[model samples]
Target: MSNKVTKFFGSPWGQRVSLLIIVILVMILFQPKFFSLDNVSSILLAIAIYGIMVCGMLFVVIIGGIDLSIASAAALGGSILSIFAKGSGYTVEGFITGFVVAIVVAILVGLIHGVMCTIFGLPAFVVTLATQYVLLGAVLVVTNGAYIYHSDFGVFYMLGNARPLGIPLPIIIFLIYTAISAFVLGCTTYGRSLYCIGGNPVASGLVGIKTKINTIIAYIFCSVSAFFGGMILVSMNMMAGAATASNAIGSVLTAIIVGGINLAGGEGGIPGAIFGALLVGIINNALILLGVPSDYQKFVQGVIIIGAIALNVYTSRRSENMKTPLKPSKKTLDSAQSAKL
Candidate 1:
């Protein structure tokens, strides 16, 4: 039984199952109505939105990097999509074109981020931090301190409001993206390279892996994830503004951390992150049901983040300690004797 428990926890799928069980138990205990069809749909909706971002975020995090600018990128994407999607006219063809343009803008932002970090050899932390601010400024500039509201959402509204076959469309979209991301990460050479680079960039480079190229690609994907999530947010809310992605960075990080992805990277995958998003969404739902203030909710989330970080550090140290110790070469001893003589 002990071995079985350990083995079960060892795999990604097992971890997700365990998380799901825990979330279900918590919901049952605290919010009995959580199992109702309406409440279940709401939970799934939140998870779907977050899952979209995590699908993309998994790439960046697995490559031993972070993308702090995701929220800002999403805000800008949402704003652009709103303008193009419903601003002037609601023709289906025009909205589709505008949506494409907004997505392109997001990709361009990601490209710039990747170039600055990979090509210029800048620290990921510093680069992403700087880009976050820059993107924030861009979002503000785009919105001009105002929101673009669409009272009549036209066809674009279907993205958020549609529930085909009683399941939200966003959830379907999330599942599709999840399938693609999982396939890429689990079945492709690029995915292996990502793990290699994150595990040890220097070693990957020495072995002929294009670390810079992979890093660039990872960042681009991460930013694109932001855009996808942002567009969903706009569709869900029927509006876009500078605050479109507000608190998004924190929320996404929370999902990653709680989902068991190591912040240092090269560990975990899409499954874990998706489960983590679900767990976080559950927490959010519980909080809402309990009528907890937003400030207190933030504080609780902060505690969760700190706890996850501590766990990551502990596990990392334990792994390092478990490794075999290296022995010194004989040449080093000879050199020491010579120096003493």
Candidate 2:
């Protein structure tokens, strides 16, 4: 029994699950209201927006790439949508036009990211970081450095806040988005290629995988997801600005890391990512419930990010150490000796 217990905790999934249970237990003991229906809904709502972005970012991360521009990209999406809707007096026709244009813009941004990374051979980090500034600049220009508020409660508002059967629309959208991402990554050939390309792009290319196209698709998907989430977010707040979803990139990446997805890429899954998001949300909520100052909360988040990365590195090294080189079978060795004789 002791050995079994030890083994369970020794596995990666087991360790993560244990940590989640421990965190939840701590929250319940210290803050009984943590599980209140309203509080739980609030936590889910917060998780939903970032969770959608996490799904998109997972694709790039799985392919050994990163996008630091998620927040800026989201801001651009929301700002564009708000501009169109507001410009047209918030009618259904205006909202649809804005939605389509925002999505197209997202696709274009993603295409640029993909081309730069794959064809131009730029580092994902540098490319995304640079584009992040460019995107924010675009947002500023469009909004004239002002927040665009949703003047009327219409389709735009319903997109984010509508409750169907007592569940928030954003939450529903998040779950659906996650499910689709999981399906693509787990069930499709394209998804399998992502892992291969992430693990070894050259090798994947040699094996007939269209590495460049697949990578481009992944980046495009990431941008589209970011935009979709951003739109929902702006709708919920009834406003859009450069600061909208400003912390999204950090939150999404942190969730990905805490879920044990390697930054080096080629090793991660939907369940782990979701678990990481849930844990982070819970921690943030706990800090608030405990009356931790905003500055301290940021400090804690930073520490968590650093600690999670360190833990990932440590575990990766440990796993590598556990691998034993293959040895020749006894029959093969005997045959060699016989042949020598």
Candidate 3:
């Protein structure tokens, strides 16, 4: 019992589980709506939004990189989708063209991120930071700083608004994407290369891994993921705007960190990311239910993030310490020999 307790406390998985339980208990105490079917459905839907992005962001994080431009990427994709579909009268051709174009742009964004970092020797964070503004500026130029609304999503309506098997379509997509990501990371050569590269780009290059190419691929995945997320958000709102993802990076980072993926890369998986995303979803819902004022919610959320980071750091260091055995002092060794004798 004691060992199990220790394991639960010392491991990220166990800690998240405990945190989940505590959150549930608190919700039950202070916010009864937390358990309602409607509320549950809403939370799941919300999770599917950022959840999809988190899943894609996993590849980048595992490669020891960061993306500060996810919000802009998402905004651009959704904005473009709205514009194309609107221009063509929301017809099937417009939808198809918009979808393809959005994908291409997403890939291009990722390529830029990867190339600048891998070839030009820029820091991932710095590259993404610069790209964030660039993408945002592009959105402003394209939309002329206006929100584009679409009256119809055509066939795409199902992706954002439908609920089959009592699950929101976004949630379903999130699950499918998560499964695919898990498989690719767990079972593919590319996945293994990503891990290796993230562990040490220089050493991996010596082993014949194309670190630059893989880094490019990782960034593309991140941008593409953000694109999908943006589409879903636009579908739900029936509008695309530049500010849609303005505050999203912090949430995504919190999810990745909370999920047990090391910020340093190559140490975490989709399971942790999912848990972290869901945890954020639940907390956000809880705040709304608890009547926390909008002005203070951000502050509270920051505090929670700080706490999770400290806990993750503590557990990571503890796990590392456990791997290295202690060397006994000479005095202790001599005392032990005498006692045994």
Candidate 4:
């Protein structure tokens, strides 16, 4: 029984599961209300937006890239949708038009990142960081540096706020989005190729994996996911502005890191990313429930991030060490020599 317990906890999935269980037990002991249906729903609702973004970000991260511009990209998406929809009196046609336009722009931005990274050999961090400014500037320009407040509460409002069968729309969207992402990553040839490319792009291309094109597609998907989440966010708030999802970069990246997805790339999955998002959400919720001051919350979060990163590195090293073969025993070596004689 002890051996079985140790074996279970040694596996990567088992470790994560154990960590989750421990967190839940702590929450139950300290704040029993954490299990209340309303609080659980609230936590899910809050994490759903970032969870959606994490799905898209997983693709790029798998291929060993980062998209620092996602927050700005989301802001741009919301700003575009609100501007066009408001200009058209909140008509259905206007909403569709804005949605389509926002998607197209997102695709273009993603394509730009892909080209600059794959063709020009620029680092994704540099490209995305520069474009982050460009996207934020575009948001400011499009929204005229003012917050867009939606008063009509039409289809646009329902897109984010509506509850179906007692489930929030964002949660449903998140689940569906995660399902699709997981299927593609876990089942498809393209997904497998992404792992290969992330691990060793030169070898992947030598094997006719079309690494550049695949990377480009991954970037596009990431941008579109960010846009989709941004639209939902603005609808929920009934407002859009340059500040929309401003803190998302940190939240999304942090979730990815905490979930055991290596920032260096070629190692992670949808389940881990989602678990990370959920864990972060629960921790933040716990902070609120515990009445931790807002100022202290940020400090606590920073410390948590550092601790999580250290733990991640330690676990990775341990796993790698376990893979190393032991030296041959002296008796086995002597027997082999006697057999040869």
Candidate 5:
């Protein structure tokens, strides 16, 4: 029983459980009425969209890769979908086409990043930074710096706005994605290879792991998740623009870091990312409810991210320095007795 208790509280899930308690306490203290079912449902709904991206980003980060292009890719996806839907008059087929095209475009962007990094030997940071600019420019060019609004797409709006079986569709989708990601990352051989690659790419290659393929797949997953997140944003707002959802990249990074994922990679999991998103979302909502200025919010987020990163580094170093005492062997004991004699 004692061992089980220690393990439970020592795990990532335990930390998240503590965070949830803190969140609840803060919410109750600041706004006692925030405990209503409606607000709780709304919070869950909001988490659904960002949570999906968080899961994918966790995977990418675990592989020692990063994707700053996520926000722009999301904007691009939303903008393209809105524009195409507006031009095509909001038919079911048009919606399908637009959605498919957006996802495909995002995946291609991921492919570009992966191929460039692998083929040209560029750093993931530099590659993703350049891709971010390109994606932003593409969104601006495609949308012509305009917002596309299509109110006639009742189906899309409903998917975003309505709850079925007492649960939001976005939440349901996020849950499904989370389940699949957990399965892939935790239970599959490929997932284990990803961790090995992140730990030591050269060593993993020497050991016959296809490091390149796994890295590419990780980026692909990141892009796909961002694309879906963008779709959700568009559906929720019934509009899309180049500047819409600009704050997500930083927010997502902050969440991932806070969720206990190491920036250097090879650690953290989907559950950590989920909890990080939840904590971030709850904090943001609380700030808004308290009427804090937008600038201050950004400042707080920056501070939180920096602090989390610092903590992660410190903890990692400490863990590395920790040494387990070795048991004495019979040969060593005999040698010690002979020295005493």
Candidate 6:
């Protein structure tokens, strides 16, 4: 019984179970009322939006790339959507047109990153960092540092705020994307190749993998996902502002890290990413529920992110050590030699 218990606790799912239990205990002690259906739905709604962005980050990280431009790309996409929706006149046709244009802009940004990384042999970090600045500058230029409002698109607002059968659309969209991402990462050859490339680019290339193309595809996925996240943000707020969207960077990175994804890549999954986002969302909601001051929230978030990353590193190292071969006893070695003789 003890061995069984130990084995169970040693499993990944078991660790998750333990974490969930701890979370439940903390909530029960700190804010027992948070377990309500309404609160749960609200948390899900928040997670849905950020979770989508985290999913994109997961793709980038899995392919051993980082996208510093995701936040700005999202901002740009949302801004474009708002700009076109207002300037092209008010109609369903205009809304569709604007939405398509916004998505195209995001894809183009992603293509630039891909080309820069693959063709020019630029590091993804450098490429994305530069693109981040470009995107921020573009947003400022396009909107002239003003918020773009789309008061005419009432139906579009439903994408972010409306609930159908008590389920938020964003949450639905999140689940759909999560499902697709999980499938792609788990069941597809492309997904397997991402792991291979991240694990060892040289080996992957030697094995006939199109490493460059795969890396490019991964960045495109990240940018497109960020674009979708921006669309949701615009739909929710009914406005897009150049300066404000920058605030999401810390939270997005926190989610990706807390979800147990290594910054170095080749290890982590969508479930881990989702759990990380949920953990952050819950922590924030709990703070609000406890009536914590808004000014102190940033400090608390920073502390939590640090703690999560530290824990992830410790556990990952421990797991790696556990997988190493145990040293053979002298008696065992002698027995093996005698048997061979």
Residue 257 error, candidate 6, Å: 1.9
Q: Cα lDDT of model 5 overall?
A: 0.83
Quote model 3's TM-score.
0.91
How many clashing pairs per prediction, in order?
0, 0, 1, 0, 0, 0
The candidate maximizing lDDT is: 2
- Give per-residue CA lDDT, model 6, range 74-187, as digits (tens): 898888777776776756666788788887887788888888988898998999999999999998999998888767646577778888887788998999999999999999
Q: TM-score of model 4 relative to the true fold?
A: 0.90
Candidate 1: pairs in clash: none
Q: Quote the positional error of residue 249 for candidate 1 in Å.
A: 1.0
lDDT of each: 0.83, 0.91, 0.86, 0.90, 0.83, 0.82
Model 2 RMSD in Å is 4.8
What is the Å distance of residue 314 in model 3 from its true position? 3.2
Candidate 3 residues lying further than 4 Å off, grouped into runs, are 294-297, 316-341
Task: Give residue 81's lDDT in candidate 5 (0 to 100).
Answer: 82
**After best superposition, candidate 4 residue 76: deviation in angstroms?**
1.2
After superposition, the stretches of candidate 2 with alpha carbons farther than 4 Å from their true spots are: 295-297, 315-341
- Model 1, range 108-196, lDDT digits (tens) per residue? 87788789878887878788889888888987887787888877657788888888897788999999999999998999999889999
**Which sequence of candidate numbers ranks them by TM-score, best first?**
2, 3, 4, 5, 1, 6
Residue pairs with colliding backbones in model 5 are none
Residue 187 in candidate 2, Cα distance off native in Å: 1.2
Q: On TM-score, who's better, 4 or 6?
A: 4
Candidate 6 TM-score versus the reference: 0.87
The true-versus-predicted C-alpha distance at residue 168 of model 4, in Å, is 1.3
Instruction: List model 2 lDDT by residue over 240-308, tens digit each.
Output: 999999878778887898899988999999998998889888887888999997557667778888997
Name the regions of candidate 1 deviating beyond 4 angstroms. 2-20, 312-341
